[model samples]
Target: MAALSPLKLRVEGMDCGACALKIENAMKRLPGVSDINVSYGQESVALTFDEDRTSALTIKEKIRALGFTPISERKDLVAPRSAPVLSAREPWWRGKKGRLVIFAAAMFGAAFAAAQIEPQWSQWAYSAAAVISIVPFARRAFAGAISGTPFSIETLMSIAAFGAVLIGAAEEAAVVILLFAVGELLETIAAGRARAGIEALIDLVPRVAFRERDGVVERISVDDLALGDIVIVRPGDRVPSDGKILEGFSELDEAPVTGESVPIAKQAGDKVFAGSINTNGELRVEISHVAADNTIARIIHLVEEAQGSKAPMARLIDRFSAWYTPAAMAAAALVIVVPPLVFDADWMTWVYRGLATLLISCPCALVISTPAAIASGLAAGARKGLLIRGGAALEMLGKVRTVAFDKTGTLTLGRPQVTDIVPIVGNEGDVLARAAAVERNTSHPLGIAIVEAATARALDIPASFGGAIAVPGKAVTTRLKDGFASVGSPRYAAEQTAPDESVSRKIVALEEEGKTVVVLLSGKRVEGLLALRDEPREDAAVGIARLNAAGISTVMLTGDNRRTADATAGKLGLVARAELLPEAKLLEIADMKKLGPIAMIGDGINDAPALAAASVGVAMGGGADVALETADAALLRNRVTGVADLIELSQATLGNIWQNIGLALGLKAVFLGTTLFGVTTLWMAILADTGATVLVTANALRLLRLGLSVRHSTERNQ
Candidate 1:
């Protein structure tokens, strides 16, 4: 037995989700193909096949048999996501579609001229024109019928055209065929525009970079870059990968990757992302992430993944159309026989009306409406740095009525400052230096606050900090060169040596003000106390207010003390659940079920449980791997206002989807009424079917403009 080989094939000519589904079904019935994922949004098919049973050549042939062209070579099959190797595109004037349009239009024009020349020869001339145009297409319709889609749009179109000619409406039949051909060309162009909005992301990053290797600068492929390698980004060039600035300074425009149009000044120690244009000055950046893991690649992968999960509305529509097309075919058949057999109406008139009804029955407009809106929504959100994982999450986001936020890293700045230092047995500097020595090597927020304060004051602290040992959830103890030193909570200090009444009073005073106070101990005696507090973000209050205006309740969940949590939440006008452990936070998330659908927004790593427990999990852009990997959605701009923007985008997307659906059905209903009353003709029938399809797809494309409008709003408020 041979192992299964995975292949990604770039497929051309897929105009909508229905086209992808037809191809997917065909591949599934093939003996060797399995785990097939055909994505219309990605314009590609990913599937695994048993090598012994089927080869890639067979897969390509299968795709071709379904009418979608598989790109010609290996590079098209499995190229890098960020590679500049898009499948070669032929000009519209030279492609298969172009020739079809030319032939149909030329034949129609020739037939019309022939009718002008001789009135007696008009019927036969137009008949020949209709047959020539519709016959070639009818063959494909026949193939589709054999493949289980008996009532496909093509089949319906062919039937309508043939029925028109049989009913002695050859003039209308040729014109209808011409209209159909032109209408399909327009649909393809509009669909291509929608797809280009996403595929354009691949063009943001350069394929090569100027790598600095041991004092010699070399221009190399970005794929060759390894972690820790230094690359020099000149003014106007994109940073080749996600990295930290190692040398030089510059203002970088990160709008392409982050949607934050403001250019940020970056120097040594500041981070830079792939595809950000360095506006001014040269920067030497130390690569932090490989090419595959950079920002642009991840965004593309996420959007493609999102495309596979169809929206609920789309699924419902798919079910509706599955039966709707067959029912329409049945109605068309009955329309022809019912009046003629029972009422004894004219056979030609009744048959012509039945042909018009067949044209209206196609359901192509209804089938494509949902995915067009969805794909545009996904592309727009990605452009604005709001990454909704799939259609379900996008829909769910609009329904969220309550948003829960993690305190330390989410609502607050996540950077605490040492507010005050009090001495009990030594000067303030002496106490602070000892505290900083113990905390210099620690990663805790409060501990780093003290160390930062010491460094700001230029304290000559001891090296190695006496090999400090951390007591989880308590303190850090070290055997300093002078004597034993420690900095910890009052509870940990009390266990070592009890503080006097005066010192205890001061500790309680700071705690009452929502400041976190830690005790400094030297040789089992109280040295002094240090106070630290993290402030709420600048946009926290405004973001929460926007949600509240939208009728969404906001709350803060934190592991901090009650006073500290309350102080931060008060600024944002939200309630706070304080002093909760990780498990306690999970319990709180479950208890909030009564308020309706809720979204938990957090730093991604620490609040994974609470996020998972809620209706939707949102991770901040600055969050660690857990947030990006596990959250239902991520706000990649890392601003609190981005939360509001995401919700706004969600509502807009849902609204657009409904409008597209309505347009599809409403137009068909109007034409159905007209055809029955003899108020519509073959021209109107063609317009009703093809017109609705073009209209719905064109309407869905409007969502792509929301990216810029929403982005400008987010930037203005920030």
Candidate 2:
């Protein structure tokens, strides 16, 4: 550390690229400066030099000589507390748009100089000018490497650039630094693309709200809205905050949150959130919470939290970079000083040899290797309407070999509908009319199904039916002309008294047929039978087959009977079936993970915990609250193959990442190996190193095009 040389300067009015370049060139012309990188971005200049030969004051004066003012030191741009906030950097030029003219003039000058000389000097000057112009921009790399505990890509690059200058291969040094600056600029653009999804979430919240006060309505900032305020939400207007309806009813289009194709009906006492739009009717909402406490705000907060959380593979990259940079630096130093001193090698040959070593060790490969693949894979999944919260979720999804599905809403249509009806002791029309009359006043799924069936038959239902009462988990009873009538579960119907043996057997047969049979009974006599069942989703069988083809097994979990569950699973090629409650589902996932990692797809409110407990939790977008809130990846289109596509994308992304790493390391190793053996020139090494980086980046980008071939391959399957 004591032997390390430093050259720091109060870099002057580098208000433009030309000013920065002019200072860099003047400093480089000095006799003993081994390396020079100046950053007007941070307003600092760095140079490694002979301690006795140069001073900070001399560098400062030379910067002023370039016709700019020199400052004492870099000042803090904002308060210390504000430093932790992730500020968006200036879009194109780091907020230096005013310097466009100077930068353009410098570029033209460098080009003109390149055209006027012989090939060798022209190349040398062109590279030097580029390097000099970018010095101020590149100095952050050098400074960060020095201050940080763990070495990064910037450290390797800094070492490489200095190694070239130390051995007096100024042309190679200039080219290496120039190439690095260009790479940094490119990498910035790629990162911005990766972060677009996160930035989009931040833009969704409303800036203002209209609140009602006294007898007049007032416009107020969204943040100022407090709990209990009455907010007037008009048709097509976003709900100002989380609140409950007080005076009106409408249909809210909650597509962004729930992904339901149809608008949801909202009436008095129904809840709505800050970003939901009232599509049809006006609603007076009594705000229940502040704007910051609303659903939209929580969503934004979760996204930011997830983005900051590290993916599993991120640590591996840090470990690799830590060792990779210092090792390259040590090797570069040996290549520069050892050959000429020990073997009496020609100075010029050794200098070129060292520069080749430095060029081959550039850290571009290591920097772009993992993140490029992750970014591309995430973008691909997003395009397919799958919302994977982070890279960690994607990694887990890739390894899932077993997927457990909740049968009620995931495998079948969640709501029950009438499929069949039979009458053994009464008129069929009379039985249906009696069942509808009993069910019309109830709100249960079975009741809804019966009422809907009665409507389909055009049965006349009176608006007001007297003596109607619902029995919890059983049947609903109503007064009939002769006696009370009850339509409910077979057990409840039979409990009043035993039915005829023939009628009981008929009910058993219907249960075996996968229908929930409810008998309409008057006192002890059986009147008729009503069959209800959840129909399977239209695409369930096709989706299951695709999963099987992709080598994944499917399991069905449900609260329904073994007979009904098995009947549904059989049609979809599912072998593992569990007729269990929500807690049992969680235990099943835990047990399955012991065999291998398992993924769960569920839609019920009870299924949320089990979904979260799985290796990868996938929520059908139209699912219940717990499922939507707990799942890691959500299929926004509610398509099962989307879950499969996410898995494929994760696998492809992981493959691309490993491939890029191998490509980068293999190419760097070959070039470095040849340079040490004295077989490679600095120019060839530079070309190979930078060229391999570009190739790896391009290969990782293929993940962005990832898709399921199932749509096209259906022709062959047919």
Candidate 3:
């Protein structure tokens, strides 16, 4: 069997979620296709299929046969393309909104002229106007009917308008088609605005880059640039690729990529990402990644994937709509036959009411409600440096009743700093110098802290320590000039050589203040103690407070001692679980799940099992690659406050979705009731359907504004 590869196609002419479902169902009938996901808001379809068994061209032809345009390469899924323009250029009268306006105007003019002519000629004029206005509707309805969706909104409108014309209500039929066309135009415009954020992000990367090679600068397409090539970026220009600054100094505006509101200073040796603007710099950067592998490209790809994944509510709505349209058709048939056959009612009036009921029952607005709000929420979160993996994650985040956090790189900076040093058997500088010599080769944060402290004091490090051996997460042991020297946690040091009473007292006092105390021992005697602390992030308190205020519980899980964990938790007013191994943390997460949905926030490596077990896994950006890849969401700025922002945005988005659904259903119910009472006409029914669609669309668009305001408030609070 050939390996299955993923493909994404930019689809055109999808007006609602039902269209997405139709395309998905049509594509699933093809050979070798799997995991098909189509998004009406993003207007794209993504799927996996065996390349040897089928081809992208075959898939595009199928979509075309289904009455939609597929306008991108299947290979483009390797690096998903930017969202396509809404439509192709056409004559002014053929443009989407413009054509609708022209058709509507023609219908009105024909109606006015018919009112002044003879009755026979008037009927002909009105009939001609209705036919012209209904052509587009009829075409769509015919396509949908053939594609196995015979009860689409277009089909309902076509039936209502044709029914009106048969009853000699040609003027009313013309007006119904005209009003429905206007509603479609408004919906298209609103959807375009909802998609603006993702489009803006895609546009941030410049197409051209200035490459510096052999002491010459040449402009080239960003796609042509290779890794290890140096790119010259000047002031007021967007960085073309992710790279390290080889020379020069300046500040960069990273708001586009990381959501950092302030400009970040960059000099030689500092890393820069693609899509960030060089504010005032003359820098030559060595490209670390090509155009397709850059940070911005990854962000765009993740966001698009997120938009394609449907929420639970969206999936339920999809299932409901499958049955909804067919059931509605049955009810309409009953309305027309039952009343007249059973009660001697007028056939014409009863049939007209049934046609109007069909128009009212179209599920366009309700079908679009959830995905529109979800796409907007995903886009908004991405702009603020929160990459929610899918609509399912977004909805889960809102319901998370408890959030468990890893300590080292999550709530704290993960960079430990030496705060206090005590020499029990030697001078402070001598003890630190000896400890640094043994620790300089270790990569642990505590070891690095000791080495940094010694270097800052200008203490000369010993040139050699004999045959060093490291114990993971515990201590480093080496042979000194006279005997063995061990530098590590107090427990590990005590196991090597018992600490004296004074040294034990000092270590206890430091650990009480939430500091990590490392003991230095030489020849079975305590040399000194170094108290290091990984300071809590500036936003940790605020983020915790915000979660607490929202009635979500917060817990700190760590490998540190109970005293240290308590001290840190007390500062943030959170529950603390200490001295946990990696597996222990996973078990604790399982226990926490009994309370409610759990969200585990970590840097992604050691917390992988726990993250996988939780309701949602949130990874900090710039952490381990495995962690970011495994997480359901990632905070690019590595800020704890992003957790709070994620919850707030999710709640707001879900709220917007419910509002749209209610509005769609409420309007349908009102109009359905009116039609049953004989108070509704063909034009009135179409107007009500169109009006409900517009109202729901406008409500979903409000999330775009809500997302912006939430981001601004987060920045302000920071």
Top candidate by TM-score: 1
By TM-score, is 1 or 3 better?
Answer: 1
Question: Any residue pairs clashing in model 2, and if so which?
Answer: 38-135, 38-136, 39-136
Global lDDT of each model? 0.82, 0.65, 0.82
* TM-score, every prediction: 0.91, 0.65, 0.90
lDDT of 3 by residue, 1-718 (tens): 7899888777766667877877877777778989887887777888998878778788787777655777654546554543333344344455455576686777768676876876667777787888878877787677667756677787888888888889888888877877787777667667667767777887889989999989899999998999999999999999998899999999999999987788999999998989999999699999998887788777877887888888999999989988998898789888998988999999988888999998889888889989888988888888878889999999999999999998887898989998888988778898899999888787666788888899999998886556679875567888766677888777777777767787788888999989988888786678888888998988898889889999999999987777888999899879999878777888999999998999999887767777888999998834423333768999887888889989998999999999999998999899899999999988788888888888887887777676544455655776
C-alpha lDDT of residue 213 in model 3: 89
**Pairs that clash in candidate 3:** none
CA RMSD per model (angstroms): 3.3, 11.8, 3.3
Shift of residue 186 alpha carbon in model 3, Å: 2.5
lDDT of 1 by residue, 1-718 (tens): 7788788877777777677777777787777889888877767788888988888888787677666777634332353445324565566656555677889999999998999999898999999999999976787687566666677777888888888888889989999988888877777678778878666888888989999999999999999999999999999999998899989999999888878888989999998888999999999999988887787777877887787779888899999998998898899889889998999998788788889999987788898888888888889988877888998888889889889998877887889899888998768898888888888888777888898899999988765434789875567888777887889877788889879999988988887787878999987899999888887777788888889989898988876767766766777899988767778878888888676888999988667788889888999835424445778999777778778888888898899888988998999889989898888898889899889999999888898986756546655876
Instruction: Write the residue-wise lDDT of candidate 2 on 1-718 in tens digits.
Output: 2243665444433422223434566777765666676543223465676646766566565555444445554222222111111245455564332243256346546645675755556545655554555455445444333333224344445555555555555555555555554544454444445445445444444667889999688988888988999989989888887789998989997655433335789999888866777898999999986766565554544443343334577547746665765787677778767877898877767666766776677666655676556655665554444567767887778888898888766777768888778886666777888888888877556788888888998987644348688765467888776777888777777678788898888877877787777888877677899888988877778788878888988898775556666777887888645446557777888888998889888763546787779888888835323332567877655666566677778888788878988898899888878887888866577677767666766776666544444452552365
In what order do the candidates fall by TM-score, top score first? 1, 3, 2
Model 1, position 69: C-alpha lDDT score:
75
